[model samples]
Target: MKEKTSSNAPTDTELKKWQGSSVREKLVQLQSIFETTKDAKLHTIAIGSSHVSFFYLSSMAAEEKIYDEFIPKLINAGEKSIKSMLEAVDSANTGELQKVLSEIVSGKTAVFLNNEKQVYLITFRNKAKRSIEEPNSEHIIRGSHDGFIEDLESNMSILRYRIQNPDLTFEVMELGKKNKAKTAIAYLKTSYDPELLKEVKRRISYIDTEIMLTPGYLEEYIEDDPWSFFPQMLNSERPDRVISNLVDGRIALIMDGSPTVLIVPTTFFAFYQSTDDYNSRWISSTFIRLLRLASFIIAINLPAFYISIIGFHLEVIPQELIVQMKNSVEGIPYPPIFEAMLMELTIELIREAGVRLPSPISQTIGIVGGLVIGDAVVQAGLISNLMIVVVAVTAVSSYVVPSNEMSTTVRLLRFPLMIMASIFGFLGMTFGVIFILVKLCKLESFGRPYFAPAAPFNLQGLTDTFIRLPIWLKKEKSNKTGSGIFNKKKSSARGWEKNEN
Candidate 1:
């Protein structure tokens, strides 16, 4: 039989020595890929006998850069000559088809010459994006308002601008076999523990899914206790917050399309912290920290505590308030637990509704929904006045938490405690508290204690945790265990004031 050749195959005369597969075959494959994509743009230039092609995704690749800078460079160096093509864009050369596809996926233009095996990749990914603004959810009165947008490179630049330390490093990886989302794990080389770094990367490596597009999706996989109510990592959009955490020996996970970065090995106290805490005076910050801790306690346990007192331990109530409390619940139709759940769920529904609505409408929904509903229920006698007071206080306290994840967790923890308190009164509340404390002490974030400094009882950590001391006193230094707690400085800078001179 005579040799058969396909029409798409290059002729014997057209054959040229190249490092990769035949140009015609690669072109056929790439053409198919381009056909699948809606915005794939390919421009081919003909040389005397050979050809050169530029392939890019119009949606992601910057057209101005491709045409004005890159193509001009390639053509100026002489697209007619293959040697000029190689010399012009010689930096990012890749022979593998997989690498070419990877670059293309990352919004880089890929150039293929007829005779060369390697593809020339030029990066001009679309830079026109949302400007860094204060994260509406995490706004602080005093601090850099520049928050992270959905661009990973921009976020990295923001971090680099703030933390100029040489030890700061980022490890970028392409995750998801099908989705191919880019993610970077950033940490200080000399600060964060090598073992914890390994563990973070190791957990990420184990992620086997079709899509890993969001940080939240990744967070679920790497958490120490997925079943636990507490968040293992802290979500932050503020560059200042990320920088402070990084300086204190924490690792940040930045995904390409996420405004929020995940800070790992986060402690229970971490969620309570805000950027404003650092910007404010130490005494005021300490007082506010204590208040937040109190709010956290009240948010999770206030309703439960009320139910306990009303159902079982009214003796603990002061003499003056006994009749008032009794009168409040006198005509109520349901038990305290039933009404507490009703109010809690109602608030949750309202909050969720507000979140789902547009900004202007959301604020209206929050204020009107809360006030109207609370007032209506109290008037209709669906919920008692005292119960309404407790629920309102609880809802307000939950909102005081700086971390939304922790806020949600706090709200959720309210119900179980409420149930326990209503059933067995004060004893149940005590057991519930003990159980939560035990879990908190036991819970770990990337193998580090979630309830650190308190569980391990480090005095230095307390200065920054329960209370804020002068920055000069509390310095985060690496201990032998790599706990990353604030160690007392060798000598106080303010000690000079003590001298009579």
Candidate 2:
């Protein structure tokens, strides 16, 4: 018998010709096209005696024999699982390629051959994943006990599980010209503002970058203006957080391989929210939300405020407290800003070093670093006791931001305000504050107002904006209707007093 080879295999001349072409072209030119999927760990290709099994790195399970045995059993169960492919078989594709890949990677198995135009889908998906855990950054006592995981399907499932209405739509687009990163846009088709959805989709679709390694990549690409320091998109890992936005006429984008989900068409207020708000007592939720907002203001302005109070406006503080603050500053030679900046920088260094170091050393670094540095700096007469207090409060306040991105933005923005206050005192600090507010006003996330329901003043949204009002108050959905709260009141509430005597 003569040996046989695939006729499509490229020769030397053809291979060289494709060398100048793009990666996709080069891939198609080869005998086995699956080998060129970039993620070498994935892109599995096994040529068996009976059939060619082409699938992803993680999808194929058992062995070549398992399919042979299982296919026959599926037919006997009255399932037309694989009529032509097998006597009995189980199959599921749902007609979407993205969905197919997601299902397969999450545990389902798909089989394709070299000569086949269509693929055989099977439902033998078995995933081993970590048990659901709290989101470290967005942890709250009262929120849903769910969080996003690295799996894209798992993240989408989180959203779907919460908002199980047909009007909720999950639209996906491939980003990164080469990487082909999967990005899913989710919004309530009926509840979402058409203009808002269209604009978000437009910006996302226009992301022409080469690589979208994370949600941050797509975040930056779709930002209204790149230079703005304020985050145009709010990213969250909490499923409840994303669901809340979806119900409020917002869109969310989830990227594969990232635990974080991006909530688009966001306002500044969204970053201040947590899942706990909706879950807690109304009063407590309102109070905590207010505290978080106040903390943000205090965090960003505390150091600058200290400088202005001590260096420029001494009359503002009580005389007794002034005496104490002055006593605390007695030996310090540096100005309030310098002292403040030094301590802040030290704290940041300790924080960053702690993160980069091993767990054992990082804890020691945080404790020892704080004690040694604070004592040494005080002894060295470089900063005042009051400045230390200011920096400490600021650092703690920065942590109050639910989103890490917003926290970082707060920290970074604080520095410039500190510098400005240091140089020109209260006038400089005032200017910096005004600049930030103006910059925020100019910022937009996917064309919707970023300062919204606040800047645009959607009074109807106030019930759930800064405070999570009782469910009854929030029962009336946003004006954009389609996928929001309906009936304006709960059956439980309405039934309570309606049958009085």
Candidate 3:
């Protein structure tokens, strides 16, 4: 029987030891030397030359296998025989060591010659990926509907296909102490802010971890304050959105093996924006923007409004509506706050259950829980019929914001406002709102004011911020200095047309 060797400490003697052996034996010996070390995906394969050959630990292994029959094959070379052999030896391009390493680590076969200093990389990577399809979250009418997939290389290809510019740069780095997950940053050198870029690089370099699951994982790590309810970075799946942010001097961080990309130096108001705003007509887009703002107010404040009015400001209710409201709440022994809390908690549970379930069952959970529980609770007098109405409207309004992160922020803020309304009525609600605004005003994204064009007051950037003004009317570009807005080119100019033409 063959004796099994221990995977740790193969050396048995203190003075004398084995000098060298075959590659396979050496690998087995190394495995025994360091059993605790992980992430050693070592393997071996046959390398092709002019003819079939064998190689192992010693450089002379190939010469030992060489036969007299192979002499003719080596002599029968073509006009470009040397070039063909060199090309065959070099699978991937020169000056792309990192890319070669990436492909090799992703299960590709790489050949390291005993004589040559460099290694030849060839892909055997056959991991099946999802086909390109429309983005579910970010639908568009006029632009490309296809979104990024889980494969990082394919997503990078999408960007390269769109921009095709030399200035567009991609810097790759490995994160995580153990996993060493690959993370990349893409931005236009001419368009991005140098200081902001340095800051982003600095923050990313400071991340100390292993195996980042997604772009959001890094987002949580690099966030100015994770304890704060608001998200400091924007996670986007749309390539166009990333490109647009790049054009606006924002840095986009793309993680390898993760579908989502992150944009930094974002503001609170930036979350409220949708790609549809750019696709639609200015007048309609501006109206939609305002409507979304109203939805945010409705989502956060409507429930608190109802609580304050029913619990304290009874005079504000109309007489007929007051009678209906009273009828709805008559049998409920709990105060307005408790009723609101109960319904809110139920809604949250239903939402969470739906999200956690499988795709087919998630829809079922949403419908059954939302319709059934809401109806049953109202019938049992656990919550008022009017309160259910308020909850439904609130849920629908929360979905208006394009960003799920911001929607979650508003949802969380509702609880505090509800509690405050229950305590001091409208006055308490007002105080809570003032607190939120104060927090927003104080927030900073990479030292840049979060409430740009609003608090510090840059009138020029407002051409597209809250309102989607006409393209022609947007004469000025975004100013990073918070200075007066002025167009580099006139709003109407034939010289620009000639130059562009």
Best by TM-score: 1
Tell me how many residue pairs clash in candidate 1: 0
Best by lDDT: 1
* Candidate 1 clash pair list: none
Better of 1 and 3 by TM-score: 1
- Give the lowest summed-lDDT range of ten residues in model 2: 40-49
Q: Model 2 off-target regions past 4 Å? A: 1-83, 86-128, 358-360, 479-492
- Candidate 1: segments with Cα more than 4 A from true spot: 1-20, 47-50, 79-91, 479-492, 495-501
Q: Tens-digit lDDT track for model 1 on 1-501?
A: 333432223234323322345766666667664555668788887655668887888888898876787656656656455555555553388876667767776788887777667778877788577987999889888878889999888899999988888888999998887668889999887777788788888998899987788999999989999999999999999998888787778889999989999988788998998888889999999999999999999998899998888888889999999888888888889888898899889989998999999999999999897789889988888888888788889999999999999999999898889989998998999899999999999998887888888987887667678888767665556522334455455545567767857
* Model 3 lDDT, full chain set: 0.71
Which candidate, 1 or 2, would have the higher lDDT against the true structure?
Answer: 1
Q: Give lDDT tens digits, candidate 2, residues 348-390.
A: 9999998899999999998897777777777787876667677
lDDT of 3 at 436: 85
